[model samples]
Target chain A: MQKVFEKPQALSDTPFAYCPGCLHSVVHRMIAEVIDELGVLDRTIGICPVGCSVFMYEYMECDMIEAAHGRAPAVATGVKRMLPDSVVFTYQGDGDLASIGTAEIVHAAARGEKISVIFINNGTYGMTGGQMAPTTLIGQKSSTCPGGRDAAAAGYPIRVCEMLATLDGPSYITRVAPVDPVGLTKTKMAIKKAFRNQVDGKGFSLVEVLSNCPTQWKMTPVESLSWIDENVVPYFQPGVFADR
Target chain B: MTTKKILMKGNEAVVRGAIAAGCRGFFGYPITPQNEVPEYMSVLMPQAGGVFLQAESEVAAINMVYGAASTGARVMTSSSSPGISLKQEGISYIAACELPAVIVNVQRGGPGLGNIAPGQADYFQAVKGGGHGDYKLLTLAPWSVSECFYLTALAFDLADRYRNPAMVLSDAIVGQMIEPVELPDKIEVNIPPKPWATTGRKGRGKNVINSLWISPDQMEEVNRRLQAKYTLAMEREVRYQELAVEDADLVLVAYGSVARICRTAVDLARSERLSVGLFRPIGLFPFPTLPIQWLAECGKRFLVVEMSHGQMVEDVRLAVNGRAEVIFYGRSGGVVPTPTEILDRIRKTYGRSAGVSHYRLNPGPEARR
Candidate 1:
């Protein structure tokens, strides 16, 4: 009998170290699958951030570099400039990309650096225990904002896709979620497009995945998926915000 | 065949030296006293088929250096004192990852945006690991424009030899001064093979350039390996210059631009029939400690002069270790000492032993009883 499914060749035998029910495992697989499908595993370089996905270098079969917290964009710029023929990408979280590393990401996009970015918007700081992030929604409860996020105190959530779309450097910018079968397919397609843009030398491309953090959200896996559809999808508005 | 000597500023020499040493990537931010480096690199780097990027901030510039270095590329970044302070985080990460790169710090007055004048106040920061954790940058202090070009080239070889960061710790006076320098011929660039770099794995296994050793036992092992590399450097890489030190009654210790001023002071003292000598340390990190200790053992008193309040004096004191007297004279906030001021200090120091007499010579009461 022919095998129906198997692990992507771009992934290693080492198991992922992500927390239970975290969508990072799903996104990691999607990125690995894209790398395999494009047959660019030999020339792909991945930059891992300092959040929950910091250990991604251990799971991915390609060459990897672990960037300092929030500096993945800058690191990717360095790598891509040195090896223009290689495919470079960064895997960053909400706290890593939207908060501490805001300057790095913005300038990288503005420079139109030829790189692909996989941004995970889980609405909380999953690595350091659920703390407030720049993407944390208003009236959403986190450890820092125990009562709820207040507009006066914490401000509103930042829509990264919309914010980056204003820049003229990016070739493609989209938002997607991997909540269900249909959602997973769309998210995978968006991720593949971002990588393809870089391979085609079109310049910077980013796909923001509105991921789930069941451990930090204080809900079961099934409940978190429903909460994303009712709450996150409406505010974030998943769609292609920029494609040039 | 010999290359013609050309007149250029010390900052321009840094760029030329880096290019000659096969450095193809330079990321820097504009700051005073060292802005000429990035300005010259912008025009010359691309001409040399290299990458020159003006990063948004000093922090980003150093991280870009980290990324390029991870790819086994000859990369560098230059900044002044304040900008270098912002780069400490990335420098620490680069050090932890054991990546080979060169960083130029044309130090100015500090403590907080003090001024844009020459200062040696960063001696402690450069030699004692400016960033967090226990690490050493193979620091080279150049006193003249010619030395700036030569040492900058040497820094790359030393960095690649040990797979550690090397620093060209210059001062504003040296960075801005213009002098004639004989650049190297355009020979073949011999970059060592980097088997561990994060270039595409190709036919080999995956390569990971990282510093995160979460396990305590593994982290300790990495630290031990780093220490071993530093110890080897200290043994073989200490560079210094000693003029008339063997027969002199007093030795003056200095580095960078201050050492140039001290050299003139030594000459004036010698003309006045005073037995004063100059001992200039070119390698500041592996610090020429044994020579200073040997001089002290031979009954030579030391006068440590600097542009800071007194930073390198601590290392001098440690080397002397109660065997001889160590006097410190310094100026801060960009106030550079003139040759006349140094000669006056040398006269006063030679007249009597009014400096730190070494605790062993006059011990304090035990337990203040």
Candidate 2:
């Protein structure tokens, strides 16, 4: 009998505790798969943030460090600097990357820190009971913004890839959505490329993953996928903003 | 081998000491009273084949220290009072994760950006778990430039030995003052094996450096383990310098730069025919409580002098346990008390005359008012 597919060797047997229909498990799988494909599982270290995927280390087979809320980039920088030969990356969410940790992330990119960043922009704060995130849409309703996010009051959703693309430090900056089969394929490819860039000694590669939080969006998993295509995709255009 | 002595600022000695102690990574921000630390590290760290990064902020710098230390590398970060406050969050995480790192607080005046001169006001913030949560840093207080060089190396050893963060709680005067430091050209630092470090876990099971224990029972277990480690440190690492405390009627309790002044005041008090001694706590966290208690049992009075409005006095009072009178004389807002002023305070308290003993005495039941 031929074995067609199996779990990535870099992924552990631990079951994910993510909410049903969340894309965190998918992204985690992609990152693990990339590590296996690169054959750097033994030399790969991960930094997980204080978000829905805070336990991302439990699922990854490589050595991992859990950073404080929004400090994953700084932690990754430290790890990468100490172990220059090892592949280092940080897994963070919109809130973790754009809000409280904005200074850390921006400076990390500006310093041209040689590390990969996997950013999940799920529109709302999924773990914290659907609070308004920095990437929340103008009309999006969250626990904090009960009446929908007002652009004037809450400011605008941050386009991290676009913002980072403006800096010369980053070698690669891209946005990808995994709401469907085709999008999922591209998301995985982007994640792999981001990791590959780090392995090649390229500096500050980031892949912003446009994901849907079904529970937080107050919709079925299927409905949330469609909601992302209709509402989220247009605001956050999916493409490589920088690749150099 | 004969070790040569060099005249260097306390800030430069800290950098030199870290390098000598096998510190391979240093992440810091430029702040006054301690800027020279990062400045010296910037040139010396790379020369020593180490990493010296001027982080964007103190928060990022400490988190960087966390990341570097998680890999079992001897890493450090130095900042002043305001900057140290910014680092409290990362410090808490480092403590909780049991990461071995050295943090230097070359303290300056501050409740909020008070001034850039020297200050010992951060004593509470350092020894009392400045960050949220129940944790302790092996805090070392150096009274002179020579001690600054040596205690930093000791801090790295102790931090790694216990797998806990160690703080070099220095003041601006000690950080800036240039004095002769008799140090070996290259110290042979013996870093213990760190099987827990996250160094890619080659050919072994995956290693995870984390502080978050989701289950309450698990969290309690983690805290119990940390507390046990702290207890061991307290037993094995209590360091203090006692001068003339045996027959002295009044013993002055102090640390850091204030201790140096107290040392002079102790000499001056003895010259003035008063039996005053000095008890300088070298390790602030594992504070020399036993010695203070022993002194209190011998019916000795205490006068705690600090650069702040009385922070370490509380610890001294706790050690005394109301067994004897504990007086506190402090000067805040970057005012370094001269030996004469401390000597005068000592005379006022020890002489027991009714001639205006303005310093607060007996930090217990009747002294609350």
Candidate 3:
């Protein structure tokens, strides 16, 4: 008997504090695996966002900095600029990246900062207990949008990958999901490619992972997976949004 | 090392000084008065093997400085009055994280976007608290182009030395005016290694984490330690230049470009047989209050000349402690008082042998409330 799947070397032994059936653990594993496989864990610096994963610095085996809400990119920009020879990446949630930190991420990418960004878009603010996120679907109901997101008032969901792809400075921009086995595998590939782009000095790269928030979505882990498969995937339509 | 005496604007001298000190990254947005600082860096940084970015906004520029500074690199950013206000939050965070970086403020008249003239209205904001939380920045106010170059280099040195943010506070006049500066011979100062930098947690040592933790005990400890560091900084870094104070009836206290004008005013007043001296504070924070107090004990009447409505006057009053009658003359909203104007005020107040007038000094909007 051999180990079919084991934790990546880049992750610590600390148990995750995420809710049961939350997909953040899986996403973290994927990033860790990529870092381990690339053998860049020693030279990689991670910037954690002020969301549920704010304590990610405790779990990630690499050097990490917990940034103020929506300031992970700016913090990452600082780390990258100071340590240009090192690989730098920021792990941010939709609320942190698209809402408050919008300017930071856009300018960093536009400047073609030679770093990677792992943007987790879960349609709702999971950390603050299911608040409506900038990427929330039109009809989605969260704590903030109790009556469902009204398109007339709240506007449609932001397609961040597409929006960032339009910027000339970014070397790569891709959208993926962890809703199903196929989607999860593709999301890992995208994450790996983002890191690879940085290693190759290809400039700014991003992989927006459509993650599951079973606790926030008011569904079991199994039901949340099904909801993502039926509803979220159709609207998001995951694929590579840009490449250079 | 090539050293040349050149007449250059204070803003341009700051840029050259940064480059000479081996600064390789500059991120700033354009603002009145101080626009030349970034413009000069844009043209010269790349030529000197550095990166110069014209950021979209002051906020973005400060964040960029945060980014570059985190890498344990010497980085800088500059702005005018209102723009510097916009950068306060980022500066606070930089201080919280104890990141070493330099910020230049070529102040203009303002509570908000005032004028493009020289003003020291931000004295309280710079020396007291410009950002959130209880923190202090190492602020140096330069009075001449040569001082601009010298202090900019000193700012980087002090920042790196203490692993804290340092500021070079200038005014539009000092930034814009051209003066002969004999560039100092570039000395090889050893920059302390930043083992705490987030370069990576490789085979060298454990990963370094820079964060302002939100725990009660942790926050208290952080604040206590910061207070201690500030105390040490105050004892070690207090700087000022006193002129003709050994025998004088009246002493004029000023800083930045206004101090230069006060120097000229003092020269003219001396010619008119007025026993007036000058006290110029180079470092605004950890202010040179001891010297002012010393002059006050000598029974010198103090007059504070400023571009703002007596902002620095409060400090002078506090230092004097009623030993000498402190008076003030100021013009806010981007107005620079001519040397003759300052001289006239000096004559009207002290030349009549009445000693000093005890007219109530308006506390301005900030102090009034």
The lDDT per prediction is 0.91, 0.91, 0.85
Residue A94 lDDT (model 3): 93
Query: Candidate 3, B21: how far from true, in Å?
Result: 1.7
Residue A140 alpha-carbon offset, candidate 2, angstroms: 1.0
TM-score of 3: 0.93
DockQ of 1: 0.84
Show pairs that collide, candidate 1: none
Better of 2 and 3 by lDDT: 2
Candidate 3 Cα errors over 4 Å, as ranges: A1-5, B1-3, B351-369
Kindly list the per-residue Cα lDDT of model 2 for residues A3-44, writing each as its tens digit: 999999999999999989988999999999999999999999
Candidate 2 structure quality by residue, lDDT tens digits, B1-369: 347777889999898889999999999999998999999999999999999999999999999999999999999999999999999999999999999999999999877988998899998889989998889999999988878888999999999999999999998999999897787788778999999999997979999999989899999998898899889998999999999888788899989888888999999878765678889999999888888999999988899999999899998999999999999999998989999888878766644632424322433212321
lDDT of 2 at B347: 63
Best by DockQ: 2
Instruction: Locate the minimum summed-lDDT window of 10 residues in model 2 chain B.
Output: B360-369
The all-Cα superposition gives candidate 2 an RMSD in Å to the true structure of 3.9
TM-score of each: 0.96, 0.96, 0.93
- C-alpha RMSD values across all candidates: 4.8, 3.9, 4.6
